[model samples]
Every structure is written in structure tokens, then in C-alpha cells.
Target: MFVLLITALIKYANVPDDIPARLAAARLPELVPPSSLLYLRVFMLAINLWAIVLKLQMIEDKVIFHSPESQLPRRVEIRLSGFMWCSFFTFQAWALQTFYLAGALASSMSAVYGTPDLGARLPVALWFAFEVSFAVAVLTSFIVKYVLIPRKVQNGASVAGFFGLPDLLMHNCNTLFMALELLFADLPVLLSHFPLAALWGLFYVVFSWGWLARHGVCWYEFLDPSLPKAIVMHSVVLGVLGVFFAIGAALAAGAATISSPYVRIALVLVGVASVARTGLITGIPEPPVGAKKE
Candidate 1:
């Protein structure tokens, strides 16, 4: 499934002739400083890697509790265990974000140290990944906070007790990092990338079906294969992702027009007010544009 994702994405990706110029957008005002931005991404990349691996190590081979179609308690055991990491939307979003951030860092370095041809070649992987990951990250944060966490709380699990450090980081920090990227990276979010984002969500949806057929469990109840409403739920998921992509694109477009770096940062933070409130994630202070490189 993962192979298919890469092949399809690369096979269909459109890399413009001016790709290097587009990828270099972050360096114009040098607003956040590419080194600073890349370091922040590296920080996110490390956290995501550690948290996801830790999550998988704990859940990988264990029998998972069913939270699917039936009115069963979350503790109700079922045939719901296999590749635990692949079973989650948050994990996948984090994975995608991590992958894209890595690619961005490498691409930036290639542009700095490698020839023009080498730099042009690198954005092929990043172009699609950035757009899809951005929307998915945004969608994950919204759903986890407003939907999944609330649902868990309603299920008699104390919010704090239900999640550990890893869960908290993946669900909350993923979107916050993407929001930071939007603010400082100066990467344009093309509305044309909508189809690529949809394809990404669809791949996961289908992969869930395959996993259901093989292991007989779904990590999410709304994606339960046995439920009649599952189709509607799936549609809603894709629809919401589309909405997020559109919003991100609009925000990126508007941010591009603003010449004042402070005002632009304020504009982006306000646009993603939900993620912006976090003390450490979105709330971490952006370095002043003209400050000495850290």
C-alpha cells in the first residue's frame, strides 16, 4: 500500500519549470530564516519519529480493544490488532508530515549545495507531499480535539488519563507544526493539489478496508466496515479534508500578499486560532526576522 502511494503520487505529480524558484520562496525576506525553520522541522521530525515508534512498539502485536460499530466499551476486546501504526489517522498524518519536512530540508540543502538540476529533481517528491500533509495535519488536529478526544471523554475516560505523552504530541503538535510551516516557510499551497490530497485520504480508506478483511478490526468506529453508515462517514472524512485544503490554500494565498512579516504572522496565527493557542507547539515564539541566526 505504501509503495502504491509513492508510485501514484510521483507518477501523477506536476513539477513546473520554475520549481526551484518556488521552493526558494522561504528565503526572500528570510522571515524565519531557513536554518531556523529547518531546525524546527527537525525538532518536529524527531518528536514524530520517537512518539510513533513508541506508540507502535506498545500496540504493534497486542490485541486491541474494539471501538467499532457495536455499542461495545472501548475495552471490549476484538480481532482488532495488526499493524497498529498503520491503523491510525494521526500516525499517518505525522508520518506524512515527517516525510515532507525531511524532503523540504534535503531539498533546501540541495539547492544550496547542488546544481540547479539536482534541486529541480527534489521538489518532485515534496510538491505533492507538502499539500497533502498540510491538509491531513490540519484535519487530524481538528478531528482529534473536537471529535475523538471528546468522544473518549464521553466514554467515561478522563481526558488526561486516556492519552499519554505520545498521543498528546501526535494529535496536537502535528497541526501546530504545519501551521508554523505555513507562517514561516512561505510555501504556496496550491488549490490544484486538491486531487493529490483526496487521493491520499482515499488510499488510507481503502487500506483500512483491506486491513478489515484481513484482521477483522478497524481502529476507528466511524470507519468500521460492517456499518451501513460507514460510507457516509467516509465521505464526510474526505469532504472535511477537501475543506481544509481549500482553507489552507486561501490562507497561503493571502499571506503571500502581505508585506509586513509581523502582520503576516498574526494573520496566519489568527487563521488557525485553534492550534495557535498551544503554549509549546503553535505558541512557541517565532524568532524575530532580523535576529542573529540561532
Candidate 2:
């Protein structure tokens, strides 16, 4: 019966000759060869590393901003000092992908046709990186393209000069890399594992608060304690990330038995969902009433 077959595939079989696995899913080996998956991991890792290098170069060079649409005579530079480099949420999400991909790449090199013996972190980290990177990529691009750039233009300034191919690699291309890995590998995500990313967001919230206490400057307007609605902003961002994780988990779970092309089409919908969450089509996100823009 279909029920019996499903149970048989997911059930543990720790026979003397069999490999051990903590995960229950028994994926078909014919779906993808290990070598091909390994190569994809390599590509993802390399792109993240390159993006990190470019981000660091931009920071070190104190990249200045300008655009043909700008009316300002003076150039505005992206100014971050000391530990401020890690304060950006986009940077943290991008770096986390690099970290996860490097580890995933090493493990995938020897992927074989047997129950995979994986560490505690890889599965959860994969889900966390996948969800966060997708959400950040969606939100950052929209904020930059619609909100930040146009606001700067209205102010007789522009920030587009600072965005480059490196920007493309870091903020926009994350979902592509993640989707490729998802196609070739099993992205295990359970409902319980959703907290890991919320915890990650919490960790950054505390770290950013510490930076504000020590440096007396908050780079992000939403998280500034001087603002009355800062806590509300923090809660909203964390809530959005949780929504992303839940959606990603559902998509991954649904894709477990589907063909690769179907999975690809379904994954594309996640980005579209994120765009809808941003409310870009309806209106530009404005500050809550009476909260002066920092």
C-alpha cells in the first residue's frame, strides 16, 4: 500500500551493513549525482566569498555616492567606522551564507548513496541561511531601488554610485545560489527549526544595541532607541523573518517528492511573496506618523 511504502522509506534501518542517518527522508539517488551537487556548492561558496571581498573593499575605500539624477554638488560617502561594519543586516545575512556554503561544500564533496551522516548545524544552518538570504535580498533591493535612491534624488543627492556588480553579487544573487543548492541537495526544515533564525535576528538586535551604547550612533533608523517606535520596528522585522522561515520550510517540505522544475517554479514564488510583503506596489513605506526621520 502507499502508506506502507511511505513508512518503509522514512523508517530507520540500522542494519549491520547500513549507514546511519538522523533525518527521515529517503531521497532518490537518481535525482542528482553527488559530484554535480559538489560543484554547485563550490560555485555558491565562491560567489559569497567574492561578495565579501567586494564589500570589504567598498568599506575600506570609503566609497562615495553619486548618480546622474542627483542635484547635489558634494559627494556622500558610505561612512562606517570601527565595528560598525557588522551593523548592517544585509552584510550579516550575506556573510552567513558564505559561512554555511563553505561548510556545506566540504560535506558535499563526499556525498554518497546512503543515509547521510550530518552534523547538528548543517541542516538548520542551511534553512536559516536560505530563509534570511532570500528575505534580505528581496527587502534590500526594494528599499534601495524604490525608497533609498528616490529619497536621495529628492534630496538633491544620490547613492547609486556606490552600488556596483559586487552589490549584485551580495544583495541580489543570494536566492539564485540558494535555489541551485536546494535543487541539488536536500534542505531539511522542520517547524521547530524556525526559532534559529529568530534567535539570529535577536542576537543582532542585541549586538546593534551594544554598538549604540558604546558609539552613540545608530546606523539604522528603525532600530534607534531614541525613537519611540524602535521596539515596534524590531518586532516587525523579526516577525517578517519568521514568516520567511515558515514559508521556506513549507516550500522545502512540499518539494520533497516533486520534480526539480516544479520545485524551481515554487521557489520563485517565495521572492514574489517577499515583494508583496514590502508593499512597494501599493506605496513607499513611510515613517510611522510623528516619528521624525533620523
Candidate 3:
């Protein structure tokens, strides 16, 4: 199911030759550096593949080495674990980000090289999908690690459920590595780039609205802009989420320099404030009429 969904999304986002030709004809400068995109694509793919291989090895060790007498049961356990892990929101976000980077790299290369018939470029949907996924990956990792885990611990939930070496390596470590890679690979972590994250969210919101305009199908209940209140709420929530993720990504990249206790305290305060602000605003209104089921 994971494979099928990813394959379908890739096919949907695959850029046709006409797109590059159109861009060339328009004579617009390629905004993205092709080399950077290439490096990012390689890095993301290598890390994800390595993580998968590691997980498979761990599964093999568990099933073959430790549980040899229970071979069939171990196999079932491994398969079930694999399925559950793949179905995780974090894993899906990681997969989407990986595929999106691949598409973006291909598209950027096509634009840079004047490849009118390049078959690997990404469409806007795929591009937006990747950007959103990147944000989701960062935010999800941050919340799970810093917020959710602590809350779970305070509530007497088993810490064993929250911390596993395999899960940390696959989800948190990979995300941090990717963030660091982006920082070093000519994509400087900047306060200015943060707005681009919010802009990406707004773009997705508008894109969904455009879909509804043409097809009469609202892609998401919160995105039906026909309701003025829904528009305000969705815009604010997405915009805030985008900015929060952007901040998290930047901090992850700059983790080496964040040695001061004061800075850490400030970051925690800011994060808490942002979450409080979002919750307060979101709770003020009921679901918009457009969001209600018929």
C-alpha cells in the first residue's frame, strides 16, 4: 500500500517536456541551484535507503538470531512491525519529502540544462507536496521528541514506548541529518527563508481553493475558503505551522551553536507561546458551515 501510494504520487507529479519548453520560452531564470538540488537528492535518497537497510537488518537479527525456534511467529511479527512503521505519519512524511526532493532536483536540472523533453521534472502539486512534507517532518520530530514524549513521561506512560534506538535513528536522526545537510549545502538557514515556508502553506491553501472552484470538490474541510471564517482559521493555522516548522528546521541545523541555557530557554518559551496562540485561536470557533457534513 505504501509503495502503491508513493508510485501513484510520483506518476502524478512527473513533469512533461512541455513544462520545461514553456519555461524556456518564457526566459525565466531558474530560481533553484541545480547543483544544490542534485546534492540534496543524493543525500536524502542515500540516508533513507541506509535507514531502511538498517531496519531490515535489525528485523533479521530479531527473527533469525534471537527467535529461531519461533520462526513463523517472528516472521509475522516482523511483517506486522514493518507495516506499522511504514504506516506511521513520520514515515509517510519522510517518504513524501524524499520523493519530492527527487522530483525537484530533476525539474531544476531540466530547467537549468534547457531540457525541453525532460521526463523527471515535478509538477506544482508535487513541489508543494514536498515542501509541506519537509515541514511536517521537522515539526513532527520536534513535537514528538520535545513535547509529546515529555508529556507522556509526566503522565506515567511507559518511556519504553517513546524511545527506541531504531525509531530514533530512522525518524529523528535522519531528519536532523537532512536539516544539517540542507544548511551546509548552500542553503543558508535564514530568517528570510522562514516566510517562504508560510508562503508555501498559503499557496497550498489557495491551490485547494482553486480545486474546489473548478471541480466543486473541497480537498479538505478546513480549506474551503468559501467560508470566510474557515479561510481565516485555515490560513492562520497553516501559516503558523509553517513558521513553527521553519524555526525548528533552522534550530536543528544550528544545533551546534545553541549551547547557551538562555537560548534554549528562549526557544522553549517561543515554542510554548506559539502552541498556546494556535490553540487559543483554533478553539474560539466551531467548524465552519462548509466543513459540516451534508
lDDT of 1 by residue, 159-199 (tens): 44225677767776777777777776757788987987888
Count clashes in each candidate, considering only residues at least 3 apart in sequence or on different chains: 0, 0, 0
* Cα TM-score per model: 0.79, 0.66, 0.43
Point out the higher-scoring one by lDDT: 1 or 2. Answer: 1
Per-residue lDDT of 33-126 in model 2, one digit per residue for the tens? 6666666677778878877776666544343333323332224445664445556766777777676677566556435443344554344434
State each model's C-alpha RMSD to the native: 9.2, 10.3, 15.5
Q: State which candidate, 1 or 2, has the greater TM-score.
A: 1
Instruction: Compose the digit string of candidate 3's lDDT tens values, residues 1-294.
Output: 333443355555434445433322211114324455556556666777676655545432122111222212222212334533443445555666666555545555565665543443435344344445546555556656555555444444343433455555554644554443333322223343344456545655666556445444442334555554675767666665767557655654564576663564456445434322122243322333444221
| TM-score sort, best first | 1, 2, 3
Model 1, runs deviating above 4 Å = 1-14, 27-30, 59-83, 112-119, 158-162, 271-294
